[model samples]
Target: MAAELRLLLLLVCWTALASSRCEFPAIFNFGDSNSDTGGLSASFGEAVPPNGESFFHGPAGRFCDGRLVIDFIAQHSGLPYLNAYLDSVGSNFSHGANFATAGSTILRQNTTLFQSGFSPFSLDVQSWQFNQFKTRGGVAYGKGGVYRELLPKQQVFSKALYTFDIGQNDLTSGLFRNLSIDEVKAYIPDALAQFSDVVKGIYDQGGRSFWIHNTGPFGCLAYVLERLPVLASQIDQAGCATPFNELAQFFNEKLNQTVVRLRKHFPHAVFTYVDVYSVKYELISQAKKNGFGNPLRACCGHGGKYNYNMNLGCGGKKKVAGRQVLVGSSCADPWRYVNWDGVHYTQAGNKFVFDHIVDGKFSDPPRPLRLACHKHI
Candidate 1:
């Protein structure tokens, strides 16, 4: 009886120790403009001024006036902000790298960036880049000098947190292609299949923790609202386009189901399907209550019902009263508005989302980010 009791105690202790919170040494991210740090900018010049002005104080390759949610995630993990995997100048890969780019999609598009304004570096390409980084980083780390200081250790690949925030562009691409809502909805499974493949690829590389964010409420975005003229009757109570939001919800539902399927496939891996759509929609719906205003308008664009012009980006100039293209300007208070440039969120909005999600209430398994490695029942 004494021996049995000792064994039982040992098992309990072991279980407690084994199930403790995960200590992720690094984070490997893949996504679109929502989580992009600098991939698009590095490949296609700077993000322009007025962007990165709030926090970074200059053009820093980010679409927002300040940091993004991925930036907050890195800071919270006690690691430096991830360098863009494409950023060749003065990049430090000691902790991790971001492969997200503006206008990226889960499924690769057959169009060019100049033609459609979509990135060629889709999710699969990002995954390929990560593989290269891991493989090359190992070679460099083995050199044992400046290389060791600049790159991550070989073991960080398996122990790092893998975050994904793509899929919004996948929806938008279909819209731009003039596909109907049902048509866009029809292709979600394929996009999600590609997404799952990427996740599985990481798992194959020994990545065990996954954090995936669903697409946000694109219906509330100024770019979508102005570019796509919807019928007045189709507007929701929240003043958002109903068709687009419904499609986003459908994509999110299918994405959640995909995560469930992925969990079964990789028993050793822990998948956290974050419901960012709900959080974003809630914020937009109750913007005043959340201390934000003009949730649907862009803070840094001009000449539109929603203060957005597709041809004129945040820093792009537009002629006013036949004068020089100087009417385009940013809002005086970016923190007061939710939409940054009619596409991405402002730093304050990103901070709000980070605050709500870090505690894991927005996650499927209801476990904090620190405990994301543990599989829940």
Candidate 2:
């Protein structure tokens, strides 16, 4: 009788584990500018010409020459591109919704966006927005018909893959405020605590699969190089500021630890931590070897050594001889360049990073993106 009971328990355990492997029907993303589709544009204004010229053929609300990494992730999953939750016009939320906005941080800031250039829609606010989307979507879907075709099925929430690509802005928010590097690092724990809160909130709402991206090496970005200039001696072989890259590495270490803790806390949920910093650093450092142009220079800008002007940005106009002239124009071959406009990645750069990570080469637990739903244990 004892042996029979033990066999029954084993069968039940095997059944539970087997049921965990289902196709990911949807993707729900939360992040900053890196993954934003159109959330910022919907609130502010269009990203404007030459922004999406490479692949989109026109302005497509992305701060790039074309699609973002998130777009590629969706394509690989056989899911439609996620529409911005804020963008009401011609948006379809059947497969997923993007709550990311440019200049977003993991934690809310004390200063206003106009003052410091950070978004008010931090991780907490974004999680609250998700809750609202789920609740309101359920109401709209109950009527069926067009609503059913638009919003996701209620069960999709539990089965969806949740992706996060934030926390970079949190570090920048401190730097831009004239805080020392150590000062910025001091608050990272607080920032990550807020991040964990959002994850727990989502888990409570039945989100079981998580894909979190660590912040990239901002030292290689033209904007950071220009804003926080370091001595020539401090510049690494890659022409990147070593201090900043070191700081980024420290941040990534902490982020990895956070993911490990989360996995322990929620054994049932699958957490995938992606090392985006390494992938980005590799591309930027060896850009020319990989058939790319100047890695640090912007494809669209006004002037200066890095082809970037803080005063006027991409799609910016200058009054030349009393006439408005488009100064921040695109480079001849955008695909050959690594940086797009001093801040964000170009479509080519985005695709390169996606290609490397899509196969799970850079992800924790070493599982491919589409198979993120499966728990290794």
Off by over 4 Å in 2: 1-22
Tell me the deviation in Å of residue 288 in model 2: 1.7
Candidate 1 residue-wise lDDT, 288-344, digit = tens: 999998788888887777788888878886567877665557899999989898888
- C-alpha RMSD in Å of predicted model 2 compared with the true structure: 6.0
What value does the lDDT take at residue 331 in candidate 1?
92
Q: Write the per-residue lDDT of candidate 2 for residues 107-199, one digit (tens) a residue.
A: 899677788888889999999999999999999999999999999999999999999999889887788788999999999999889999999
Clash number for candidate 2? 0
Candidate 1: stretches off by over 4 Å: 1-19, 318-325
> What C-alpha lDDT, on a 0 to 100 scale, does residue 120 get in candidate 1?
100
